[model samples]
Target: MSGSFSTPTLSTEKTFTFYSQEQGNAYAQARPDYHPTLYQTIIDHHLDSNGQLETILDVGCGPGNVVRALSSHFNYAIGLDPSEGMLTTARSLGGTTSASGLIRYEVSTAEDLGTTLPQPILDESVDLITAANAAHWFDMSLFWASAARVLKPGGSVALWTSGRNRIHSSVPNAAAMQSALDEIEERHLRPFFEPGNLLTRSRYVDLPLPWALEQPIPEFDESAFFRKDWDVAEDFFAFQPEVNMDVFEKITSTASPVTRWREAHPDAVGTEKDVVRMLRRVIERHLHEAGVEKGKEKVKGAIHGVILIVKKKI
Candidate 1:
């Protein structure tokens, strides 16, 4: 019942496929929601100047988490994702109908956005552009250039991602996790880290603030943002009795290990089941080692994020 899943060779020709619509819906249910403070900070940093936030664009908006979180702030919000399954889930998450009819969902790739929005919509029409956790998948150069084209002169772009959650803060455990990640990177992700590797590495540039729209903006503050670290044993898994396994399955299905294994062993029979088993074991072992009791199955971890604010250069 237990066997190591063979790592797959990386390839650029691979097509990224996310979980099914059912899976995406389940994921939307189980995944932790972002902090409200984080949303307020983003608004303060980017949209506060106008006195009233208007149009917003969410790129790679998986299941419309950002859209749901910020729908009330903007006059209108549009969410775009490449996966139809994800978009379907997003729409179902009250995205299709909001209080103001301001939320909309589009199926589109971050790299190819033209298909998603018409020229009129792209022409300096948006006030804010935000990507949460999805920025890493973008073609940085093209995406930034395209984003610049669509954004109003004074519009703001916010990119933020959450780091891995760890259960313990002990130096030894931290070091061990680091080492484990390093080994995985070297053994599985390294060859793919290069330009032509399976996973494309794109450099992100510091977002430029617009000076044309002068609205009173708050000072860039990192401390105001939540800086949290958790021991998964204590924080995440302890609530396992209430933890939703369906959500866990959906999240794991999108993991790099699962996707890479699928690509590497495309012809392998029963690959999907094998991938699932392997992921469950990996997650369980990591959780256990992090101090969660075995058979008690839970996850604990910490997350730290930053908020940046800048006015456009006049």
Candidate 2:
């Protein structure tokens, strides 16, 4: 008889529920682009170990940043996301696909990977599956099951995310600017944080996996349905985000919690009563007092990320 078990009800989906087209566009525009080396490192290592690395699927590919960057390496790249707003911005702003390879965007969630993909996309055909800064929002059980079903014999899965942003500047008031930003998060935005923020803060290290944690999952039986399981977590430090003050502010404005809060209290954000606005003003004022003008100053920020790669048995 078939059995049933409880599934965890954990998600940060609501944080994105309030994503309007404007916010989606802002996210696509203001967010820092991942370093090319991040993709190069993975592609180089995969090519060295495996043979030709072609077709790729980027799950929960909000605004399609990873797809646009990584598509050239593969013959075909597919970006899947549940949000139409995000997909809209992704299509509009992600630019044209290259002549060598192309990217296609789909409106689907990680859980729907099995059925939502085109009929022509044969099972066990995908070469690589990636989730860039998105795995935290996925229902891992469903995602992993679909991944196992769709990936080729030796195909790989790469999941990564980053968080804990900070500001750095050459000016003397940099500490005050950093402090103001920290207060905006801890003091103002803390109450608005969705449960998903916890997962992001932890860099998804404690995320669920089907394989046994204590010992290796046993080899597949005669059924030969399940592939061999192997997984590793790699950390990428020294991921600093350098941008102009304007871009930095734009990035902060794209914060989901802050955006949601502003949506609820529109009057606060536009007027003097707005905490986010106030936070931005405080930083701006501090910068000005430090003899650095807005739009003219450049600041660096911190971003810590981790990649989890799982490979099926050959």
Candidate 3:
């Protein structure tokens, strides 16, 4: 049930770059961490292709979640994001790098790839470059060119994002609940969605690969490209299989489109007319119709996921 598509666009100043300290904190609290298998799959694939594990650069690393989680595996870990608020949150949640190395965060963009940082990343030194749930926000053609410069000859680039979601079959009146969710997306969120959101919703099938860009980056080995997809039953989201309504609401509120909607209708926020609150009311009504006791209802949903892994030419 996809809507209209837009040309892929970069993460613009008008969007996530506007994230304030409070917004970033709320984002960190609401978003689910990537599943361990997601990381391991990237690592195993990279290792199988003889990729090194010395320096990692996670682009668009909001809240530094990926870098912090993968810190122990690499000697040096660097996270870059355009938002200072997100970087600040990342720094506060400090994690350890290798004994002889350091963990750092820089306010930077995927297009920059740390070249303009006070301490620029070493050219051809990064062993793994990752963009988790963030690549759709990039100008991929530019990102690939920058990746070529920052990555070692056999380094790997891993990009992953979850697709548009659905209510899990376990939820009461799951079909009707899904329709309500879809209705919200159509009536409330779609208008505010940027092109990047469309790409993620398409599971990156519409995203450009290095070789497919206007000025193709030949440094990547398209022949060895790797992609994996997980369906609703495949556990890609890694969020709790069950959650209370309040927790569910927080999760739903973190969506980029919803953020845009809230921004546009500040007065409606928290009122029954608010998109989130409206969703809650509908959900509550569904629960009541399904004979759920007050405060006893739970919500769980399914989202497809896809990961794209490309290796720099050896």
lDDT of 3 by residue, 1-314 (tens): 12344344334645677788787888888888877888888889999999988988998888878888788899889999988888888888888777556679888888879898789987898999999888888877778889999999999999998887777787888889778868877888889988888788779998788897768899999999999998874556555467787887788888888888988999998788989888887777898899999988887778788999999998
**C-alpha lDDT of residue 38 in model 2:** 68
Please identify model 1 stretches exceeding 4 Å from their true place: 1-20, 48-52, 96-99, 111-120, 165-167, 170-250, 266-293, 304-314
Candidate 1 local Cα displacement, residue 187, angstroms: 3.7
| Cα lDDT tens digits for candidate 1, 154-242 | 67667665534332443224555545645544664344332222211211222222221133123222223222222233322213233
In candidate 1, which residue pairs clash?
Answer: 166-301, 167-231, 167-232, 209-312, 210-312, 211-312, 230-302, 232-300, 237-298, 237-299
Pitting candidate 1 against candidate 3, the one with the higher TM-score is 3
In order, candidate lDDTs are 0.53, 0.65, 0.83
Tally clashes: model 1: 10
How well does candidate 1 score on lDDT at residue 171?
27
Tell how far residue 10 is off in model 3, in angstroms.
Answer: 4.9
Off by over 4 Å in 3: 1-13
Rank candidates by TM-score, best first. 3, 2, 1
Which residue pairs collide, candidate 3?
none
lDDT of 1 at 40: 70
- Give per-model TM-scores: 0.65, 0.79, 0.95
